[model samples]
Target chain A: MDKLNEILLNYADVDEIPDSASFRKDLGLSSFDTACLITEIRTVMGISLEPADFIKCKTVGALKDYLNTK
Target chain B: MIEKILPDGSKVTAFPISIPQQFMFFMSAQYGAKYPVNNIGLCCFIHGGADLEILRDALYEAISRCDTMRLRFTPDEKYKILQYITPETEMNIDIIDMSDIPLEEAKLKLQSISREDIPTYNCEIHKISLIRFKGNTDGIFMRLHHFAMDAYSTGVFLRDASEIYLHKTKGTAYPKPMRPYLPVLLQELQYINSPQQTEDKDYWFRSLSEADEPVFTDYMLDNRLTQQQKKNPSQRFADIHSGSPEAGTLIFSMSEDESKRILSVCEEKQLSVCAFLSMGLRTALSVFNNNETDVSFKMIVNRRGTVAEKKSGGIRINYFPMRSIIPGDMKFADAVNEISLIQNDIYGHCSLSFWDMLIERHKSMPSDAKPDSTYDSIGLSYQPPTEHIQLGSSPDEVIWFNNGASMIPLYLTIKHRTTDGGFDFIFEYRKDPDPVYDLNIFFTKLRGALLAGAEDPDITAHVLLKQLKITDEERKGKNNG
Candidate 1:
């Protein structure tokens, strides 16, 4: 599994995971959880990310795309 | 009835203390009389082109406006029963000239002054003093026994004082007077004795009967890190003197933008800021203690606006134990939902007093089943937004210096300033000769967890445990070994 997917699976139901699934709406993730995800991505991907950056990526696909850019 | 008429023609009312104040009085008596347990001090710096005389008059006006400001507690014939007396006389405001002293010295003097304990045997319930520095800054100091007022009352007093000062200085009309606590206390007393209160007490009794014993003991005992310290020679030597603990406070703040983001995230998740912080705290404790899932701590809730409490303030707060069992395999979102539900249930019956809950628990459960008062040594409190009082057009900057002893082993107070929308986290902990945990690391981890949680709402507790390299089985195995 990709790093993002692995992190998401720990928090969200596997059945709920989809490329277009919204982290906030579909996954029911809190801001704190989102923050932890960003921190994990920073550590795993070796890049700095801000809250605004993650906040802009509403879906799993969007976040994945953003991570690729980094 | 009128206690006494002041020379200034203000009427004084004598009334019985509320149930909450009675609880504090009893607790103080039970704990020893050498030190006041819940005395709180608030000191703030005033920077503006303001005169000392005008500020003094404003302080006097504030005292006259709020009965709590003039409130005094006298012991009645009943043990630990205090009668609330609103003396009509003008409250003395001591003005000291620190104009020649250096700013650092002035601050040290203020700190020393704030730490001074109130003479419980005295007739006065509170004190207000001021210090004038050489620079444009002046200081307003207030020290009050918990029986006299609470944290909310401090805001009310400041707002009133500032309004009175503005009216005196700029000829602005003072806001309409708020109803005093005397009549409110009387009403509260009647309500507490009513059938509704009895029902609430029953609800609390049932809740306590079903509540689990605090899981903190388990975490403290099972954590490998704390256990490893037992082998250290210095730590073993210092443990002998750990009984007598000195209390210290650590204050931290987050910028406006950070606070706003966290708040917005909380709103998005349908969780209150208090709930979010509580979760962060639980997660931090869990991770710190080998990913222990069962987290328990008492959360102090303000009951001022609640039905059982008096709308006018004089110690309307209660501590309720918040217990959450976040399974190591549980998703973070699921844990948040579970906590939110539990919080809702607890808040529904929050009007029940902590003392009453203790009494009920002791009475309802067998000796072996009854939980001890070990849970009382840690608490979390969140201060709601209050009116901001500015000294000048630039807006008044007030920095709170807490000098009182910690009520618990660890008490965390989260306050959001209305003036700047910033967050202040004050962690007051007992400073023992042999500390079990490093508070600096604890605070840093908690803050990091909160910030990380806010940044990535999709991260599960399991993932967090993995990322932080925490393994519960390994920790437990070490403990067993």
Candidate 2:
């Protein structure tokens, strides 16, 4: 979560990104930014993810669930 | 007789158009006879009930405010000059009843209408129509030639028209008239004849003389040679100036999240969005051309805000060539930064007209060598965020489409939509037999390359090229031959 917060910081204010916040609708992460976040997640959390997966998991909590499954 | 009252309460019979307008008029006369070139069209869909009479009056009022809408082109020996006329000439908004037609059929009809050509040269270059659909939905189609207005002017017209419509509907006072095009036109004329133009001419001549030959031409030549050797070659050839060419558009968008990330990257790198996108395009093209070191393409720059031409309401756009050389081992971030610097330098001198550049290039070309007419094969335009206007109860949907014939083979317009904070990528390309490049595949790879670069900014461009595995399939035949 802290790592996710760090990556999100590049795009939005730290306070803006919450567990329930949607990356696209709420945070307005562009396609390139989402790609960067996906790469960062793989590098930091050691979880390989696809852009489609991130798109599907719109919120941080959903993303965590997907990561747990992975 | 309709009269235009000057600032000092004097009447003027005729006025000259701006330099850009004159340029467009001449170019259209030379090239736009077969198809309507440089025509901009907008379709605004209004929902709920709105008075048609009030809407008509509002449109007329909008036209009355801007001299550009009331302009007609007069041909001279050398150039077709523009003259503003009075509204006494009949300018009726064509109202079509689409309520009786099926929705699909109505849409098909609308598409056909959009393809229809308007008066191109030495004529009135603006028209408006209203289409009434079933269930309280109405659509307004406004078409303006590039000589009269640009993309920015379209927004301004819509905003003012809507404001006037709202006021008229409520029986309120009309809004103030917009800044006329005469002042802007005069300003542009002064700049065109100034010493700065001479300096610009010199700068362009030096730049083009020093620049490398376009890489796409080489790619096409290689492809053509390969095709000639094939036993079952495709019947179609790659011709830049093929008559009866078909224009097609491919649109893609970046998600809000992805847009935000790119913005963050740009902000951190001190690069403009346009520069960042251009780098991505350069990198992608390099990979596509089998790791070509240098990629060159023309880019359209709007000179409306420049010191020479500060007024914003008319056509002030010109195309200039941009080249980026990529080292095989350079990191993606470094490549982007380097390209950004090059872009800044090119943009600083973008005020130089493309026509002037061509004339300069033509002078230096050897008598035996063919004149280079291939620069227009590809172009990139980055449209900044435009002011959004609301027409009565906020439109349920707004559709903007370009109806003009494409002057280039492949033109990419990257528009940043402020309402949604998203990017709209429009790729308008000409149809050719045996296309030099597969546009769909190219766009997909472009998106992938940009995403990959964003993910691992430290990765060298060479590695990205390897991943993409772009090769000269067209060159394969030539090698065999």
Query: Given candidate 1, what's the lDDT at residue B181?
Result: 72
User: Fnat of each prediction?
Assistant: 0.00, 0.00
lDDT of 1 by residue, B1-481 (tens): 4254344554444456676777777666654544456577766677653677889888887777777766665544543344545557456888888889887887777666666767664367678888787677787877777887888777777887888898888898776565567666776677766886788788877776676543442223244324535664222101121233346777778788888878787767655566778887787677666676767777787755321222255777778878788776666556666776676566656666677776775664434333443433358888755657777556566655555455456778888765686888887766653223344455555677777777887778877766654345534544554
- lDDT per residue as tens, model 2, B136-180: 778777777777788767766776787788787775556545665
Q: Candidate 2, TM-score vs. the true structure?
A: 0.72
Cα-based TM-score, every candidate: 0.74, 0.72
DockQ, every prediction: 0.02, 0.02
Inter-residue clash pairs, candidate 2: A28-B256, A28-B257, A29-B256, A29-B257, A29-B258, A30-B257, A30-B258, A30-B259, A30-B260, A31-B258
lDDT by residue for model 2 (A1-70), tens? 6776766665543345678987655765443345446656788788888654665686888887887898
Worst-scoring 10-residue span by lDDT in model 1 chain B: B233-242
